[model samples]
Target: MSSGRMRYAPTSKLFIYSMSTLYVVSPPLEIFEGLKPELRQRIVTLPDFLRYPAGRIKGITRSLLAGRVALPRRILYYWFPKAYFDCLVQARPGDAILIYEACNVRVLRAIRPYLPERVPCYIYYCNPVGTTFRRPAEELQAIRALGYRLTSFDPCEAERYGMACTGQYFRYPEHQPDNIDSDCFFCGLPKDRAGTLQRLRTRLEAEGLTCDFVIPRTPAEKLTYPQYLDRLARTRCVIDISQKGQTGLTRRPLEALFYGKKLLTDNPEIARYDFYRPQNVFILGKDPEEQLRAFIESPLAEVPETVRAAYDVNEWIRHYLP
Candidate 1:
């Protein structure tokens, strides 16, 4: 199928290239379900090679070779080139390819030689800088050298790594519930902040406020995307505990806006955004109990439609895949 070009602005010289197909090279994520119907149909999700028996054996062999300093882990793309080649070869001119995170460096490397010159390749980094899981600077530089457009939700982190800041996006619900039952809700892995989150939960319950806090002890305990959204929809306020070194906006803030639920967060940097309102978002700090109590008693504030539309899934997809 032939793709088309989308003009975003009259004054701008840049033209957003439309894609006939999108090859998402990442582990399965529920976010893909939010894609527009036309775009969703063209998606091709890549499988995790380490999940298969043959692929698992290859992974072990590669790890052993890298452990002996014989081969750099990044240059071991030849070991798993089939998946990369399969997708790359099918990408016709004008098609778009998105690779999530820097962990897919080996796949990107393997596909570079097979990639169509006219096809656009994009890389998205969702993690913060200074993390062991993040991509190496040299590897990112090499990817950029190969003409792949790099972007990140963390604007500051993106700039530090010389990538474009695309911000974050979330799927907007078709219907918004009018009744809110719970005072506050939060669900996530209890990484290093387990103690801090537990204390907050205790304090909220002590004040007779209803707080639905979930820290999954195991993978099976984790809530599905729809279930998580349902909880957020029923709550008057949502709590966000940002990970260490996190400077970018997470999905919580966007969800809060879409649902008109107040936000209780520890990220001080959120106040800098244009959408920040003291009545809508309460930053967690000293005397959080006092702040939480005050916020819970106040009426929810309305977010401007313009601001909300800026982060809408349709708008975000246009920006990312246009």
Candidate 2:
């Protein structure tokens, strides 16, 4: 495996690298779909699932290759084999290759001696998998030595890894599923039905901020994206507390920004993200009572549109993605 960097402008050069094959082992098609045209022309997708049964797997694969099924251009080697390793070794220099999994990175490292020294390797990160920032010394040191640039779906996660001393972290645009109805105020299961939520609600109510509460549990109850967006429009403030305690600003906070809804979250750690501590989003301490009351009593409609736009996805793309 060669360690080097290659840059290609979309216009003058498309696929300047010798090998055109690109192997993606993850779900997001958005990242590579934007690749230069010539590179896209010679791409193969390896399905992550290949071991179940030849009849079932091969039949589906044939159907896909036959154009009966729709899949992104990529290839997945079902079982690891020496032939795969051999092909990697024989791969021409300047072959633009990418592997997105830790296991695959480990495999490539195991055979590093056999690979050319200049192959550009990029590692995609989704999450830390195990370490929380509070306890991340060992994992931090190991990732730094891999000598690969890191790209992640979540900007906050990338930032967290950076804090832990991992590779340089970059944010790749996320593939937010269309299934999420952006118009709804509350996504996820209701706190009432999930006893823990009911308890939290009880505590909030006891504090006397008696606002209307909506809970959407199952798929059927989930509002359409437009509806969710509309609900956020109707609300003065939205909540973005996480089940995992105080951590990164989850998708909910980002969604809150998209809808331009003011937020009151229990997660103080959200302050780590850019545009967090400004007038648009507020932090609620462990005892959310006083702050919650003050916010409820304050005139929220007076908050300016500029403040609301701080969470705008467009702004996010400009600041983080670009």
Provide the global lDDT of candidate 1 against the true structure.
Answer: 0.71
lDDT of each: 0.71, 0.45
Highest lDDT, which number? 1
The sequence of per-residue lDDT tens digits that candidate 2 reaches over residues 1-322 is: 1223343433222222244444333323433453444434444333332222266765565434422233232333332333333344455644434444443323333344554556544454444434333344445445446555555544456575563212212122233333322211344555423564566566556766444456775678776655554555565567765654225455566555544456767677666655464455666554445565565445433434565444443232221110
State every prediction's TM-score relative to the real structure: 0.79, 0.47
lDDT of model 2 at position 204: 58
Q: What 10-residue stretch in candidate 1 is worst by lDDT?
A: 8-17
- Stretches of model 2 off by over 4 angstroms after superposition: 1-76, 80-119, 131-147, 150-184, 188-196, 203-236, 243-246, 272-274, 277-279, 286-322
Residue 188, candidate 2: alpha-carbon lDDT: 57
